[model samples]
Target: MTNTLEALTVPLIQAPMAGGPSNAALAVAVSQAGGLGMLAAGYKTVEAMAAEIDDVRAGTLNFGVNLFVPESDPSDPGRLAAYAAALASMALELGLAAPEPGPFSDDHYAAKVDYLVANPVPLVSFTFGLPSADDVARLRSVGTEIVLNATDPEEISAADALNPDAIVVQGAEAGGHRATHGQAKEPSESSTHELVTLAREYTDKPVIAAGGVTGADIAQNHFDAGASAVQVGTLFLTAEEAGTKEAQKDALLSGQYRDTVVTRAFSGRAARALSNRFTERMAAVQVVGYPQVHYMTAPLRAASADNPEGLNLWAGTGFAACQLRPAAEIVDEFRSL
Candidate 1:
């Protein structure tokens, strides 16, 4: 409750990577290593996420949970329908039927928030968008410290209005989905260094820099650039304890993926992912909706799990620095700086 930066011993945070990357084992390992480990609750049922939280508590007490603030508006059904048809082709190839588009759910925002409020954790961070002021107040009433993710100066200013305990300045170089509040808003092209610097100029709150940070050198660079700490997601993706799929793990290590690209093909919302066949095919065909596109591609993604070329292997610009080792060792590498 009202956790401080000191709750994170090494000032290194294991970024909350959703969609099967971040897991209890990875989080507990990072926390055990004297760093803050975060559980990604995006795309998970409230019950499943709570079970994972219980597991994390059993492993380590110092940890945080990150949630995706549900999209404010559902995507156009027609657009979602069209995207579904495109994904259906891949679904059929995988021997799976294409799922029909449905009304978008908030990924159980109310339930998850209520759960956390009733059973508070040491820390809670929000991404994709900021939580409602009432919800933020409710969590704070229970003494939970709130941290909001922001990608640019405007978003940082917006977060300041909520008076969060801390802010994560996510740069464009960040892996996974860009956390811009508006679905249609363009993400800033600034590097983590520049974003952190700009965010520092706007708010006095503790700023945690996220994106493309693979090692102590990169972490130190962010610290020097005015970040109080650095959040690294891709680095741990290759860690032995990470929940990253074997295919995704292979893709990161595969020299075949020479560069990472920001694409909306996989999840609709623009996110940084390893270049793959799916990304190439759906580049122009994708829609601007979030979980709708996210749900539409679910079947294709599941079917393509075996084929690394077809899956959305999310990674940052520093993916090449990823290593296959214990997560604690990965944390140590960043903490040593």
Candidate 2:
């Protein structure tokens, strides 16, 4: 594992937004602008991730791949059923039958690791949980720099024990799923700056500040707080190269959403999304069954493809400052800070 922060012309890393916002073209553009671009390997097959890696490689080698470590304990079956029942009405609204929960899969974690070992990239990061010691060794043996995400001081201590090259300090304000180590534990509410300072007290590993970073000044504040680099995801959702759906982009740009809240209603894992009809309606009834609840709501989300109010509009608190532009321009703007 290596620290590529010093080699970067812009000490910024684009957060690997797992759903549709992330794409090869967007990653390449950020890398071309002298920042680290990343491919989100979550919710994708091993082959699909490899194809995207190839696409990014075609433009630049300064890139990384992010993956979700498989959940150790399966989500409670009772919770899955309960959540499915709760989503039945939404399914009916979409002219579909009652939602059925599916069996949990490991997200092909082992195979994706194997692929990365065989085709090593400059960096590889893990969210949800840290990989096994042997897995980390194997990836490092191939010259792949490893980064692990941490939400609070306790998680930072856990990540330090793994001895990764760096740690992504994801604050509570981060968009998308909170990278808590286990599904059962409640995530901490430390801000990005506080997390960065807290992490420094535990380890000397590079700290990459993530969450609510909107512009140059905020990113600079993170650096001043001892972060090696700043990672931004929401800011790039509107980039020309992004694969963000039109509904999501329009909702974000419309100024209709005055605030964002962390909700498990959409995916059963705590994620920050703009307040909408789905979040409001299902807030009280949702359960903690990640991929299961995520799948159960899939048909409804697809059926409401054109309606932003029915879908997950993941965004950080700083989303209001987001601008529609090219990925390169976004990275360049952060660099100039």
Candidate 3:
């Protein structure tokens, strides 16, 4: 198969919502429906990621796998410890032990890349940062298209320097963690359309616009602004094939979360999630740490999986348009866009 997203019948990609939303079934359903489906490898083990890859391959080869480009530990021990101490009360409420500064992790980036290199796929995308040129070349040699995510002009230029097959211009309005190259840096405030226009000045390579795509009209606007395709995440959270938790799915369609805010409360990285008790309570004390903070809050999240108030209700600005329906129907709305 060719290593380009242009092969898709529909110029839409299902955003890779890691943790729970994106999965084998959702990937298969979206790919079969003419849009590109993506598998998230952000918070999964090598074995689990590999298993899902095998499952998706069995159903379709038109899907892509997104990997979190490993970032160096930017967490200060003192800040982490302080944040953990702040979580003591919340942990107690959950009947769990106090939180601690969890160990740093690369999220197994090298091992997952090694696996993908050994077992090639149609496409691979990187977020947070771009992989080394050597790693990019290795994947390219196996006919796997390499795509990188960027949130601003500098990031776009940096990604273009890597000569990726494509670049995903994720706007600030995007749900989930902003794809800023460094965990410490703030994401650009540009809208998806604005970034899509700015991306044109950086590289002639295909630009895929992501963030706040809730309707066909929004997708069309991105295309009009020179995007080759648009990727939607929040809208797919309620899809029938999605692996989104019941509480989250219901919250999205229930009109409970009226607005989304960018906060570091959940994973210690700046991610846009619906305003809730956890976000409000931890907003001030939240620190700039990633996997460690992500790990530190695992118990709190696990204990409140069924409670939307305590969970990270990740959503885009257009989340109000989200509807619970079949994945194909969602993809079809953007067909031929």
Candidate 4:
């Protein structure tokens, strides 16, 4: 077996969801249950991320860390300023003060990379973009298996040039951010099945299917479609051990938000989030930056944390199938397929 599949005792890889949903408890539980667990180190500081790695190490020896590759250009400051002002008005309606624009950085890519190299983890995955050949070679020298996320044939071809251990074929249905190499690139509308097949045509490396994967049937479908394993995110959000917010959980289970749409309103980069009043209102806005827009909306998101109606409830098309069970049980369900 390749390192990608051999690294897993079970054929299920817990999708690393950044910005708070992926936690050590969930990662530890999944690994303990015989699946490959992943920690989302996209938004945390180096110290905080190191502490999280220690937490996971304290719980299990088998797991992986996922990083968000920094964007080449910072988000447009002018657009972020305009969006902040617009969000401030909404904040007032909720009895909160406007948020001050904070200095934004890309999760400190170099510091985090150095920390990982010095304190090696079992597996490391990259999303949003690919790392340089030097970075890839350095991590590989330390025996860290690298997996890069790709959404289309072109991206898969580019990732193949780096000779990754495997490719995470994230289809259009995946939740959170799309893994396009550039911010301005439009993602392909290929379904998980189609994308997995396309990726296999490009590389001999293992392809792990992601996007809207919620149950045994979906997992089985991906495996049949040539995926070495299935990466699931939304299915675990409702798990008892998940770090998902209370309001986000309620909104996903409420059955009120019937559809999921790709919107750039929340984070300058397009992501799949539940359609809500806020998303609908900002649909026409000229938001084209990532962490900048993400930071700009921090105040609004924080103030409306209590109200699910006005917040971004991150979920997938399979949100209805999400269960409030233990991570072990969730892994068992995937294994039974």
Candidate 5:
């Protein structure tokens, strides 16, 4: 039998933190602990996503995969060239070759949907944008529950048009990329609770609240605001089961940073990350182009894996609550009373 969100005793959904953190181990641990676990399919090939899905399948049945929806030509080629030129000196300092923008990709969005349609899981959530009606129908045909992420009123209405099983109300406080559907628009700065409340006016579908989920108190507030489940990503950054890099874990627990700022420095998309040298230096030069910007900076980020200042330390506003502990314990902290 396919497991549904209603069947979850703990109404908590682990936010799929792509690029790292969201992994098979983390997903399985949280699912086994009675919360819904998620695997991020962003920046991964279809074969790799399939492997992680297989791993999660081995451990538990209550797991989901998140895909980054493709967008149209989001940035000008001239802007990318200028950005690459700006990154040359920094790359040289890191002993890396200057990055050139690669061809635009849908992040293999079509192939991934095909893979999911053939082998469905209990649920599938989309970030960055919503899938087409045909794509949603194909996935649903295989018993996969569809979930879409929306950042504001316009997005909520757009998501509703697709008739997803649920919608993730991602607010400004969300870490990683804001799910604005396009790079041309500014991200919403509403609080998570505020987003959930506002979303009620648009869609009648179940709401999964995300962004800055601290603990029971915050989760309870979201529940009161009409959220059926709360999705947390930052709080789990230090989880033992997560694939968070050492630099990020240290930066979160080190207490060296004071605040998180949203900038397109890392991915050309608005994402909240800890204050760092890279974000500061690249902020002015950052332009709007997703995988293009993301791929251009991959080498720099990879080389700076040991240096927090040079990496994208994605974290939410409530990052202070992050801890290095078992994911099960974290899930228990958000259980309904």
Candidate 6:
């Protein structure tokens, strides 16, 4: 068997966009096209993740799975209630009940880890926080390659200590949630090329560049800066194999959304999304809750699926360059560039 990084025929990896966009079909297509495809394990149940893992396994073994490492940031009930009140009117306008904040959950982190340990896979990556050294040992013991996401030089040092197979250096230009270790601190604004260089100063571990990677030139820049590969999410959002909702796909190419902002209004944790009504209105009253605020606003997001302004339009700065073609074409295009 080849080392995970060396096995990639193309040095591009499909970013694991959690929620609905990432699916087994997208991963399979990317893998078949010479790049590594990743299934987003965040916001998914163990069984659902297992099914997707099975689906990917049936097609290719070059794919990977990315999990959100659970954090223990407790949400103040009063703050949660206050933010819930802030969203009340919008919920009512959509014929929904006032948003109810749920207790903080680890998103079934332990269960998901156990599942992966029992049924080993090709690769496993983590974000949000570092997994325990024991967990890393167990996974590595099975020959599963481990990768961790880092947003700054400090995070790179921390992840390096755990001895991951590689580190994904996410720049400020990335979309969706900024994978800061905790929900309390703000993310850094370093560019992908800058981060790759900075992280190399801390550790010799291979760095996989992410964020605002729109085309071949940017990918080459990272590789020139000593990056092993470039992980892209925004470019694949519009791929035909992607599960991106129609509303989001239209918003990406509609010319209506030109800018993206990093705000915590939607999930109570800072994330990058197209500036829209929900983010704009809730910006002031935003609270620091993870799954709590995530669940609190679920009904509103679901009810307003047809209304792009009310949904979490997660896209990176390079979203405008996304092409509406098969994922294989997108991966091949990146490889040939």
Best by lDDT: 3
lDDT of 3: 0.90
Candidate 3 deviant stretches above 4 angstroms? 1-3
lDDT for each residue of candidate 3 in 64-136, tens digit (9 for 90 to 100): 9999987754788999999999999999999999998998888899999999999998999998888999999
TM-score per prediction, in order, is 0.96, 0.98, 0.98, 0.95, 0.97, 0.98
lDDT of 1 by residue, 1-337 (tens): 1265676668888999987778999999999998888999988998999999999999998889999998865577788888888777777778888767745778998999999999988889998899999999999888788899998899999998899988999888888899999677778998888988898778988899899887788788888988888888998899898999999998888778887889888777889998888888888788888877777777677777789888888999989988788988887786666
Give one digit per residue, the lDDT tens place, for model 6 in 1-337.
1386688788998999999888999999999889999999999999999999999999998889998898756677899899999999998999988888866778788899899989999899998989999999988888899999899999999999999889999999999998888987788988878999898799888889999999888898888899889999998999999999999998998988888999888888889999998888988889888878898898889998899999999999888898789998888767754
Comparing 1 and 6 on lDDT, the stronger one: 6
Q: For model 5, how does the per-residue alpha-carbon lDDT over 1-337 read when each residue is reduced to its tens digit?
A: 1257977878889999998799999999999998999999988999999999999999998889999889754688899899999999999999999889856788899999999999989999998887889999999999999999999989999999998889999988888888888887888878888999999999999998999888989888988889988898998889999999988999999999999999888778888999899999988888887878888898999999899999999999999989999999999998763
All candidates: CA RMSD in angstroms? 1.6, 1.2, 1.2, 1.6, 1.4, 1.3
Clash pairs for candidate 3? none
Candidate 4, residue 90: Cα displacement in angstroms equals 1.0
lDDT (Cα) of model 4: 0.84
lDDT of 2 by residue, 182-266 (tens): 7767778889989988888988998999999988898888888888889999999999999998899998899999989888887
Worst 10 residues of 1 by lDDT: 1-10
Scored against the true structure, residue 151 in model 6 reaches a CA lDDT of: 95
Total clashing pairs in model 2 = 0
> What's the lDDT for residue 323 in model 4?
69
